[model samples]
Each structure stands twice: as structure tokens, then as C-alpha cells.
Target: MSSYSGNVETGGAPDVRNLPGLRITKLSVGPMDNNAYLLECLSNEDLLLIDAANEAPRLLELVGDRALSTVVTTHQHMDHWVALEEVVAATGARALAHPDDAEGLPISTSPVVDGDRIPIGDCELEVIHLVGHTPGSIALVYRDPKGTPHLFTGDSLFPGGVGNTHDDPEAFASLIGDIETKLFGALPDETWFYPGHGKDSTLGAERPSVPEWRARGW
Candidate 1:
């Protein structure tokens, strides 16, 4: 089994997970404790960072001398992209986000819709647009040929339930519906997902609670 615990803390050491062709480094930063994931293709060492949450200095330190190719913001949340401008400016990496939330970001981002494929050297990530947390909130899926699929869910999903919808019944419905159909429905139980905050979980671990989440309507 993988040694990665998926546990990180603000100002703490990051946890690293190694896959067949990819290496994932998870670090927590900012006051909100947002998780930033660095996906490196083992073949070429090309890197793609999944959220420039905060603390540009720490992020840059983690990157070291490697070139960062792209920075994909999970959503438009201020806490999530607080370090986007700085990280992008420092690394000269291209910024990418869903078109619906692009305007909220500090820097201009190229739109990446559902089903769009992002390449990090030889490995690729498929974008899955999840509505509710934000109009363009997305999760990136990396299907490992040698292991189970890995999902990087922004605020759209978590261990216990879906992201907050500010108690809007309609928004909750849309978010839950999309998550059910697009995420839980399409992906297998073994798929392991890393959320924007907190620890990681597998679909199997959270699958049983889907009904409870829908009924409570939070």
C-alpha cells in the first residue's frame, strides 16, 4: 500500500505519494489551510501545480529549481488562489481555470471545461467540471495505469459531504446532482480523491453516505 497519509498542516511538512509515472506532493498553506498539489511527471520531471493557495515563498521553495509548466486553480475562491498571481509570476506558468470562474482570478486564465485533457509530460489529467461550490468548480482526474484513479476535488467534494452551497436549496440540488451523476456515478469505488482542504478519501468510503447528504440538504 502507498505510505501517503494525505494529511498536511499549515507550516508543516508536505506528504508525497508516488505512482507509476507521476509523483504527487501535497502541502497545506494560507490561513484557511488550503491544500496545494504538485504533480510531477516522472519521465520528464515536468510539473503542474493544482492550486497556488498561499505562501509564495514556501511554494517556490517546494518547486526548487524545476520549471513549473501550469497552474490550475480549482475554483475562484480567494483563499484558493491567493498566491496564484505571485506563483505564476515567479514561475511564468500558464494559468488555467474553468471559464465560468475565470474572471474572479487575479490573472487571466485559459478556460478548461469538462473533458478537457491537461498534460504533464507523459501523464495527463482529465478535467471534470463540478457545479455548486462555484459555477466552474472542477476536479482533475488522473487514471494511473498501474494503480487506482486519483482525483483532485476542489471544494466541490470532501470526506463527509459536498462543498458548502450557502444553504441555497437550488444550488445544493445542482451541486449534489452533478456530484452524484458525474463523480460518484461515473467513477469507481476505489478511486481515491484529494480535496482542496483536509484529508483525502476514497469513493468507497464516502459512497454510503450519499443518501444521507442528499436528505440533509446542506
Candidate 2:
């Protein structure tokens, strides 16, 4: 777990890769240049994307006829999901997310919840609740036998800041508390955070920033 998170800028495309057990790649999309990730966990062909938005052409180019498994979303934001139907059409993969986030999706689907685990090849993904950014937002934890745990957080948790919120002040605070109680402070120092909009970070790297974030009351 390292705090070496990358703060990517707008317009730049997401970096692509094929890692052990999980092939995670980031796609830059939307007006805000949100990041959408495409993953191939175990067995190399089943693709699971974290978020899909503006870069349909590039995303398709990346897929290039691979077998798609599913599209898992952290939460529903238009920039993170505008190209969903295209993703589904191209890959024949279903879109899944927390039930609270279903309302925010372009197409309708049943909401996902905490404690649900979905399997992809030999890997298993555990859904964790860290609902601060959005009432239905979720963080996905994927642990491989290699001992590195990956946390795919939507807008909930980030490297130095949490997701932006304007709905309920109490809920926003609650979300922050949840991240402390259940995420960076709660999980092992090595847990990796894969956020929806920015670069990758870890528990050790993101922990010290929490108090500062809370201090500003943002």
C-alpha cells in the first residue's frame, strides 16, 4: 500500500494494462473527463468495467472483441455512465451497481447492496457500503491470492478528498465517517483505492488526508 496516487487531468486518455489475475485499465471520458475502468479478472477474457462514459470509440478499440462479463458501477453519474448502452451493446455485458445508485443510471437495473459477492473466473468481488457521495454509492473490494486488495470506490473515497456532496449535510458527514470507520482507517494499510474519477491510491496514502478533509468541513 503506497500513497502514490496519480491526479490525472482532463482530456488525457486512461492508461491501459493487463495485470496478474486482474487486467485493469482506465478510460478518460465525459465533459469532466471522468475515468472508466475495464478489467479482465482471471482467465483473461471476461471483462468487467468500473465506469463507462464518453470514450465509446476508444473503449471499443480497447475491447477489440474480448468476451465481456459485466459492468460494475460505483455510483451513477452521467459522465461515468453515458456510454453504458454502447458498452452493453458492444460487450453484451450487464450493468450492475448498488440499489441506491440504480436511479442514477441511464437504463434500469436492480440495485446492488452491501455484502453481495460476485464471482469473475476465480476471483471474487465483495461490495462494501461507503455511502457518502451518493446515498447508493458503493466501494468494491477485490482480493486475490497474491495478497493485494483492490478497492474500487466510486465518488465516495479518493486519494486526498472525498466525493463532492450538496444533498444532505448530515449524509455527507456520515459518508466521511463511514470512510474513516470502514475504509482507509478500517481496512489494512495495504488496501488499494481505485476511485471513479482520479488516479489510484492506497490506505496508507489516503489515511492522513481524512482529518484535513474533515477540518475544512468540505
Candidate 3:
């Protein structure tokens, strides 16, 4: 994956994080700071809300009535897209997600697949398929002008860990293997990861821990 690091700020509804081709904003709402992101096109004001978890008022206050092109859900977990109805109602936006996760949520979603390009203003978001966390989990990858790649993992990988699994007994090991060999290991140390439920971590910082995770048979 490519690294797309820019300005990540706190406070206000629009916590702007600048990348080469885009500007990212974060909102920590609800019981957890689920890291709902706002990607506004630099060339245009087209907005994309990544994981509409909670704090509708706060998130709306951040976006402030901007017209939204779409809202993307990382998984079927309520915390990830619970606020989708509110967000869509507020902006008349279309909601999208993995086809497998369709029936569980409030709205119909366009199935996100590997290598799909999400257009945000002048920039493009390349889709990275991440499974096992759910049947159809995906990570968003983008490279900035500086060549730094940023990955939006959405509860798949964290600073010093892989992700949490509550499904099948074998899922833990399978997902961990995918993260270690496919997702985490293939990316650059410069890659920055923003998960669905915690603090952000860099690829460089989260790398060595992969082997330990494998040893534990997780």
C-alpha cells in the first residue's frame, strides 16, 4: 500500500488531515473515537465519509452541511455505520459497503471490491480487499505527492496488532496470516494505518509484531 500522510488535527467537527492529493478530517464521536473520516476533494468540495459511526451533530458540525457524494462502511458492525442514516439524511448521500454486509445495515450499499477506485475530487482511492474480519472487509489505500501511502484498515490492523475476531475459531489465525503476509507485510514502513476503533499506528511501528502474532497462532 502507498503512504498518504498529511495534517491530522483535533477539535472541531472537521479535523483536517492533509495528504498530497486529498485532505482527511477525523471525528471522534460516540462511546469510542471510531475514527470516522471525511475526505474532501481539494479541487472540489465533494465529501466522502468513511465509517459513519456516531456523534451525528458533531460530525455534521464538522462537515457543516456540505454535499456528500457517498458514505463508505468498512464492515457490518453497528459502530462502523450506525450513523449512516443520519449522515445520509443530512446530506442526501448514497451509502456503500461490501455486498456480503448488505442486509445487516440500514441502507443498500454498492459492493466494494479489490482494486476499485473511489473518486474524491481530483484524487482517487484504490481499494484493498481485506477479508476474515468479515466476509467482505476492504481497506482504502492512497498515495500522496510525497509518495507516502496511507491505509484505512477499519478494525483489521492496528499499531501493534492485527485485529479482533469473534466469528470462527480458525478465523483468528486466517485473518492474522492475511494481515501478516498480505496486508501488513506488503506495505511500506511509511504506510500509516487508521483502524475503525483505536489510535493510529504507522506501518513501521506495527511490522515486527506480525511474527509474534503468528507464533501465538493467532
Error of 3 at 132 (Å): 1.7
Sort the predicted structures by TM-score, highest score first.
1, 3, 2
Off by over 4 Å in 2: 1-13
Alpha-carbon RMSD, each predicted model: 0.7, 2.8, 3.5
What TM-score, over all chains together, does every model reach?
A: 0.99, 0.88, 0.88
Which wins on lDDT, candidate 1 or candidate 3? Answer: 1
Each prediction's whole-model lDDT (CA): 0.96, 0.75, 0.76
Which consecutive 10 residues in model 3 have the weakest lDDT in total?
1-10
Per-residue C-alpha lDDT of model 2 across residues 1-218, encoded as one tens digit per residue = 32223455566655654446876676666577687777776574677777776677777777777777778777777777777878787877878888877887887665668888877766778888877687788888887677678788888877778888775678779888988887766578888777887677888887777889887766
Off by over 4 Å in 1: none
Tens-digit per-residue lDDT, 39-117, candidate 1: 9999999999999999999999989999999999999999999999999999999999999999899999999999999
Positional deviation of 193 in candidate 2, in angstroms? 1.4
TM-score attained by model 1: 0.99
Candidate 3 lDDT over residue span 35-109, tens digit each: 788888888888888988887777777678578888888888888877889888888888888787777788878
Of the two candidates 1 and 2, the one with more favorable TM-score, higher being better, is 1
